[model samples]
Target: MEDILRQAVGVLRSMWRFRWWGLALTWVVGAAAAVVIYTMPDRYESTARVYVDTQSVLRPLMSGLAVQPNLDQQIAILSRTLITRPNVEKLINMADLNLEVTSGPQREQLVGELMSGLRIGGTGRDNLFTLAYRDGDPKRAQRVVQALMSLFVESGLVSKRQDTDTARRFIEEQIRNYEEKLTAAENRLKDFRLRNMALLDAGGRDYVGQLAAVSAQLEQARLELREAINSRDATQRQLQGEDPVLLPQMPNAAGVSIPEIDGRIDAMRKTLDALLQRYTESHPDVIGTRRVIEDLEAQKLKEIEMRREAGPGQFGSLNANPVYQQLKLVLSETEARIASLQARVGSHEARLAELRASAELLPKIDAELAQLNRDYDVHKRNYETLVQRRESANISVEMGATSGIAEFRVIDPPSLPLKPAAPNRALLMLAASVAAIGAGAALTFLISQLRPSFADGRSLREVTGLPVLGTVSLLGDPRREASERRGRYAFAGGVAGYAGAVAVVTAALKMLQG
Candidate 1:
């Protein structure tokens, strides 16, 4: 600790020995630094605050019907894009900030400088944002800030309107496309129906039902025809018999003995029953069968009355015999029934043939119809969705036009600054004083190192590594010593005077600036 203290004391003494040179260097450097600081151009800043209103009175009423703009997101986008080249150019033109820039590179450099000087920020946890610009001229700074504010607000509104219009136009285009598709589908379906109306009408019965009905009717008709032919043959044979002229003992009117007529009535009744199983009573075949049965029964009753009134064997011819006549009538009726049944069978066969022909085209028609229906359904759904969106977009546009739902209000207007915000003179001067002192100390140390001298015996021993044996003292004339002392005082006075002059000049400059 003692050694360190001694070293510090030695340095202070060496500095004091060259105090005049230190003072001169200090004053010169400090004055030069002060001048350079004062000559720097002053920069002024202007700022404006804006508040965004995100809520509106009509918002609740139009909640699901209209789109709501995101104010914070819009503000973030504006902050990033506000200083783009095009916007900067617009600002430059509006503010007349020519900056004497004519070439492309020069203009680009100017834009960059302007962007660097401009600042946009959002206040913490609020809907308020600030726009600020820095420039050498206070008025220009204020003008730039005002221009930024106007551009930001106008751009936001214009962007929102453009988005709304775009949405509406897109929906309209989709609706037109879907409308054309739906119309085309409908036309195709109509044409298909018109081309195959017959098949479509029969489609209601289904293939299985039609086939079963036609088959059942064809089998029944064949059975009835066969029975009728047999009955006709049997009646003719009975009429050819040798005893055909003789009548059987006549029974009561209620108990007629006409086997052929009775058999015909029974067959008709069986047919009616079979038909009833498959068809309603109102069906044409059922009605026809019932009528035939009633007629046969009436004929049998008439024959019974004829047999009761005729005497036994009075009519000798087979045609006059009541039983024979009855048999003949039955035979003719059976033959007619056979003919009618043959015609029905033929008609049924023809209908089956026609159904088979139509069935061949069903698969192809179904495929095409299914595709058309699918397309129509898809287009219909898309058209409906687009229509709803279009209505919503229209509502949003109307709301934007009428209401200030996402509006920017200039809460704090830009103010023209009277004083420069940069080039702090007091701070600059203090820094200059510190730098000057450092430089003065460095110069003093350099001078002392160049003119090396031992301050004490230990220093001499350290440099030479030799022993110091004796000390010598020089005696001088009194008058010469006194003259040297006076010269030293004069040198001190000169250095003080120079330092005082520099201080006075710096003070004068500061006063003039004020």
Candidate 2:
């Protein structure tokens, strides 16, 4: 510790020995540094505070019905994009910045400078954001901050409105496309039904039920025909042993009565006879009635021959016996029913064949129909979702126009700053003082090293590695001492002049700042 102290004392003494030079250099360097610092441009800062109000009076009413933008995210984005090239250019024009460059690169550099000077920050865990700008001019700094605030608010509204419009247009386009698809699907379903109309069971009766009904009717017809043939043969056998004139009358079958047919034939003959009485045989009504009577007579004769063949009996005037005629009528009716049932059976068979063929196509048709239905359902769901979203978008647009939700409000407007924020004068002066002192000390040390003089016996012993003898004192010369005194005065005068010059520069700087 003592050694360190002694070394420090030695350095101080050496500095003091060259005190005039040290003082002159210290004042000159300090004054020069102070002037340079004062000449630097002062930067004024202006700031504005913006509050994001995400609460609205209509929010409760439109909670689920309107699109709500993320306020924090939007604010974050605005903070980043607020100082873009276009916005910066607008700020420069509005504030009339003192940039005189006309070239694109120079303009870009100016914009970059503006951006670098701009600062945007958000308060912790709050909806408040701050916009700050620094510039040489206080008013220009305020104007820049004001412009940024306006851009932040306006850009948010514009972006929201544009998004709503785009959403509505996209939904409308999707709805139109789905509508066409739905129409086509409906038409295909209709055509499919129409094309397979015969194969489809309108009454919901399955194929098995239809086939059973037709077979049952066919079997009943066959039973009735068999009964009628047996009755006809019995009647024919009974007629062979009896006289034709004395044959007994018989009751008509349930569904067939010879008497009724005979009455119809008689009525037609009488009508024809009456027509012949009124007009010539070649008259239209007369010819038509005669043709009808002839057709009935021919039908009766055919029936008689059918009965005779059915029994294998000799029939003499079989039509004259009412029993045989009745049996023959029943036989003819049964045969007609059998023929009708056979035709119906054939039709049923064709229908069954058609059903089988349609059944073969059912799986493929069902698969296709299912796919169409699935597509229709998907499109329908999507269309509905789009419609819902479109409604929300419309509501959001209306809410944006009427409400303050997701909006920025400038709580504190930018003000003209009175003091410079940058080029801290006091700190710069202090640093200059430190640097000047360091420089003076360095020059003193350098001069001492160049002179190569020993300060004490210890330094001499260190240099020569020899023991020191008693020190010698030299007598002073008056003339030399007088010259040294004059040199001291000159050194003092030079230091005073340098100090006065520094004071003058400082006073001028203060006047310029004022």
Candidate 3:
């Protein structure tokens, strides 16, 4: 410990020898720091607060009527993307920042600077944004912020309108497609109906329905014709058995049964039963069957009325041969009825044959027609819907143009800064003073190591590895003592004055910054 203390004292003595040089170097470093601090440019920050009003009364009022965009999310995205490179470039143009830029690298550097320096704050849901920028020039800082604000609002408007326009264009194009499809379907259906006019009727009668009607009529007619032939054959047999000379007396007034009428009624009843098995009574075929039965009954009532009006003499004359006349009359009546039934049967048979031939082709046509009709209806519906959507889009565009979708209000406009906002020179000056002191101490320590000296005989002996018989001391001179004392006072005063100068500069800088 004693050796270490002596060695440290020896190093201090060496440092004291070069103290003036170290002090001068320290003062140079301090002055350089002060000069740099003084020359640093001041940066002024411009700030703007924007409140985005995403809510609109028109939004709810036109809910289903118009397309509503998520304005809050859109504005949030705009705020975030506002500091992008392209936008920063546009901001430069808007602020005329490119006027001084002479080269592409400078412009690129400016863009990067704007990107890094631009600041935006606040959350999407809050809809409140703060844009800030700092520049050496206050006017330029304020201009940048103002241009950014304009760009933000302009981007929102342009992007929104573009979105709406794209949607409307797509809708319009689809509408045109559906319109063409609808028209084509209509023309196909019309052509099909025109080509097969006989197969289909205005009452929606197709091949199967026509075939059914024809088959039923043919069956009924055959039945009626068979009855008429039987009646006519029976009457002819009876007339062959009876002699022409043996005139029978007039028969009693009791009326005979109209078997032919009963047979026709039975045939109609059978037809009704067949139709009922396939369709409800509400079906057109079923209704027609009931109406035919009523008509047959009405014909029977008219026959009865004619018989009563003509009297019993109408059946046969008492003076003439009653049985011969009655038999002949029955034959004639059966022949006429058979002729009418045969004609009806022939007409129905021809119709049934024609319908059956068309059945092969009719079914395909019917199915295709149904499909076409369905497709047409679907296309028509979609076309109508698209037309309505187009109208809605137009309304939205008009509304956007007139009323504005999102309202932007600047709560705090960008303003020119009155004072510098950056550099923090006071703190830098204080740091420079501390650094100067440390540099001076380091310089002295370095010099002490380079020019080593021994303070006593123990250190000298240790360095030489030899014995020191004795130590020499300078004569005790008061003049030398006083001169060393004065030198010590001067070194102390130099250090104190340097420290005081640093303190004064730091204080002055702090006042200037404020």
The TM-scores, one per candidate, come to: 0.54, 0.54, 0.54
Model 2: lDDT of residue 94: 68
Q: What would the per-residue lDDT of candidate 1 be over residues 62-132, giving only the tens digit for each residue? A: 98998776767876777678787788889888777776678989888889998888888886457788998
Q: Which residue pairs of candidate 3 clash?
A: none
Alpha-carbon shift of residue 335 in model 3 (angstroms): 14
lDDT of each: 0.75, 0.70, 0.81
* Best of the candidates, lDDT: 3
Cα lDDT, model 3, residue 374 = 85
C-alpha root-mean-square deviation, candidate 2: 13.2
Instruction: Tell me the spans in candidate 1 whose CA falls farther than 4 Å from its real position.
Output: 1-31, 96-110, 188-368, 428-514
Residue-by-residue lDDT tens digits, candidate 2, 75-182: 677777777778778877766663567788887888899888888888745778898988888987898888888877888778767777888898889889888877
Ranking by lDDT: 3, 1, 2
Candidate 2's TM-score reads 0.54
Q: After superposition on all CA atoms, how large is the RMSD of candidate 3?
A: 11.3
In model 3, the runs with Cα more than 4 Å from the true position are: 1-39, 84-86, 102-105, 200-363, 425-511
